[model samples]
Target chain A: MCAQKRAKSDVGEGSPARADLDRTRAVLEGPEIGRALTRIAHEVLERTKGGEGVTLLGIPTRGVPLARRLAERIERVEDRSVPWGSLDITMYRDDLRLAPARALGRTDIPAEGIDDRVVVLVDDVLFSGRTVRAALDALNDLGRPRAVQLATLVDRGHRQLPIRADYVGKNLPTSLRESVTVLLDEFDSRDAVLVGPAKARPAPEEEH
Target chain B: MRHLLSAGDLSRDEAILVLDTAKELAQVSGRSVKKYPTLRGRTVVNLFYEDSTRTRTSFELAAKRLSADVINFSAKGSSVSKGESLKDTALTLQAMGADGVVIRHSASGAAHRLAGWVDGAVLNAGDGTHEHPTQALLDVFTMRERLGHLEGLRVAIVGDILHSRVARSNVLLLHTLGAEVTLVAPPTLLPVSVHTWPCAVSYELDEVLPKSDVVMMLRVQAERMKDAFFPTAREYSRRYGLDRERFARMQRDAIVMHPGPMVRGMEISAEVADSPRSTVTEQVTNGLSVRMAVLYLLLGGSESGIGNQEGQA
Candidate 1:
């Protein structure tokens, strides 16, 4: 995933980059990330019965590249093309009022609507499952899919919702203070997954 | 980017970001599914103190396309009709948890005023003669669509400048995007401080036409005219209106634009308005995508999440 620029002024206590440098550590490097995706692709094919009528919808940012890579793998194995698109869940998130306003990303749905087709949502990391819940709500508005499944590079277990990924590259149990950051070649010009302590920052009003 | 009250508030990068986002969102319109779930649970209020069809509808549609729940509060039907103050109305929207307020008011700087009163993001639809930032964005979006770029391109804004919020906003925004703007209007219609703006002033429309890559025609507000800005409608048409003759003189690739509600004979002839070079219709369509982009950026999407992070920080 591309490194989202967290504003320096907005970082509550210490320098965000400095804090990242000190506390964050890589859990999976480039080669490991590639292997995980390959295994997930095979699992997806096995689950969906050779990937027929399956459409890959990547959640924006890292998920998009992950979805594309999965589709490429599915094509090479199954020998059939799988349609892919990007799903932006900004509007459907439940915590919109609780959090600051976010920028909307592109929602590029394939020309063939999701109706009666299997949809596999791809993402870099599955944390909290809030994004998945929002993605489900977003997908419902587009069309009724035959089945909706999720494939993630990492599942840092602390799901606040009743959502689970059918295909998980790694299941890393993490605490509330820890965050899993994903890096993809398509965005960060490298592939890796990092686990770091998420500092308890002050609330927006409390910040300078 | 938080509160788009004026075109002057935008830097070149911020303006380009909106345009780029609009370009990406424009693709959604062609898809099998026209809606996106970016703002599904968010509330967007369209608060209009002035009567406007195009802008209000465009914003409403833009919000709807992004799956935002829109509540259109017009002055004639709303509590404002009962003399409720802007502050009271803002407080009410705040109480109801509106995530964004797209406001159009008759008074200049009304949106800016509303911004200070509301906690949610405030988008200025058109605040009197001060600015209509989205309209300018859409115009720039259309210009870039036609010409492929705005840098160093010549744009002639023709007709009323004094009472035109469109002209004012366009000058500010186009200038920021690296385009050279020339305001072509009768001296009486030009603002007194026109020289202070980052543009050239021109009295001859014909001279500016051949050199301009884009010609934007402003709507002459007949109702707002208390004094004679021009001798007669016929005289204005003959002198400043973009008729077939002037249209022919423009570069063959030159695009004609009008922030609509056009007085066909007074500011633009029917022939030219309907001509192939005119982007009046496209502007309306582009308005939806442009508004969508602004709302998306301000509200926070994953790709452009830079907006809301500041709120928490």
Candidate 2:
């Protein structure tokens, strides 16, 4: 995992990294994401013995689609629906000012209401672990879960917080100056994970 | 320091404490960071089902000032308008792991239902005409900032008390803060069981203006406004509006306040709202401070239970 420049701010909005989101979208839909999420679903089912009372929670934006796909795959294999909900974890980030301001998304839980259920947190990629830590804090405000597990489509690990995805689809290692971008078909036309230079750059004056 | 669901929830002492804290927070609003990080990483969601630019935006800014990550959720053009139930929407917030939910809804008791639905702290930003706790809190904060004390003070809240959540919240909260509140509205515009409230009733704003230490004008909500509440807007303004003549009746020290999005010449003339004695603009400024005080004390600073925790230090 990339560990260089830990203080690097997010490449957001007008940042060039945002422009390259299209490239990441192509990678997501192109057989690779389909293969990865399917593998993760299979592993989750094998570990949980067909996900009895397990709730699949997707962190907002990217995580939501991944969670939906995992739930569909789990249902097809098990012949029963696994409860699914979407979470907006924007509030939980430790470094809020590091990224551009964003509107909060929807976090929708199933009717069963989280109590006594095994919750599996879904995210696109596992980077600094700060997102998951924030998710933990956010989960506390929800009802008590019997147990909570973490799942990630990409484990490009650079652990800032003491967090680890319980279920991992694939692990890729890279330098700190690199970035991992995940795109899905629902919001993006293609599915892909791209390894690229950090999109954040200095002002135009420092271009030389 | 708990969720401010209603102004009535705060006792006189609690109200004073919040105002005092707000004064201190106002001093640092222009700093480079312009943030305290007091609620660092704490999630505050603006789950608004009703359309509101002023209230929603103000609450969002308030949360941001305290260093809370604010998520603005507008129901318009979303799945919510497409028949997605409130339960579904609330579950979404729960899954997102929101820390605090500040909600505004057209339907009364929407906040109550949301409280039962989410495990997070629920604050009623504005729940129909049932109550608007923060608005009332800010109004009180404005009053305390200008008047110094609330006890034995005469506060006249004029206009559509029947359809105003702000009026309902203010009346209850002001009385709790030891102020004598008089509700001046047309008899037809008063609530059916208005006498159950802590404040006295008056059909005439002019008759009550002389005795008032504070004059608070409530907006005549244009959308839900039913006719015959008064003959016409002009007549209502003539009777209840704080125009120059009405303003002259108020004590020289009496401050005027409005929750805002004011209809310049309708409820109050522009001159009265812009007057030196008016606390209308100050109400907006005080809103952030009061909200900051609420978020900090509820989520942090548990060390100060009440009354002089500083002396021990």
Every model's TM-score: 0.83, 0.58
| lDDT per residue as tens, model 2, B182-221 | 9998898789999899989999787899999998898888
Q: Count the backbone clashes (under 3 Å) in each candidate.
A: 12, 20
Best by TM-score: 1
Q: After superposition, how far is residue B248 of candidate 2 from its true place, in Å?
A: 1.5
Candidate 1 per-residue C-alpha lDDT over B1-313 given as tens digits, one digit per residue, 9 for 90 to 100: 2677888878787787788778877877765578876676789999999999999999999999988999999999778889999989999998999988999988898887777777788888998888998999999999999999999999999988999999999999999989999999999999899999999999998888899999999988876788999888899889899988888888889999998988888889999999988999999999999999888877764233322222221
lDDT against true structure, model 2? 0.74
Candidate no. 2 TM-score: 0.58
Q: Which stretches of candidate 2 lie over 4 Å from their true place?
A: A1-208, B301-313
Interface RMSD of each: 5.2, 16.3
Runs of candidate 1 with Cα error greater than 4 angstroms are A1-25, A201-208, B1-3, B20-49, B62-106, B110-123, B292-313
B-chain TM-scores per prediction: 0.95, 0.93
Best by DockQ: 1
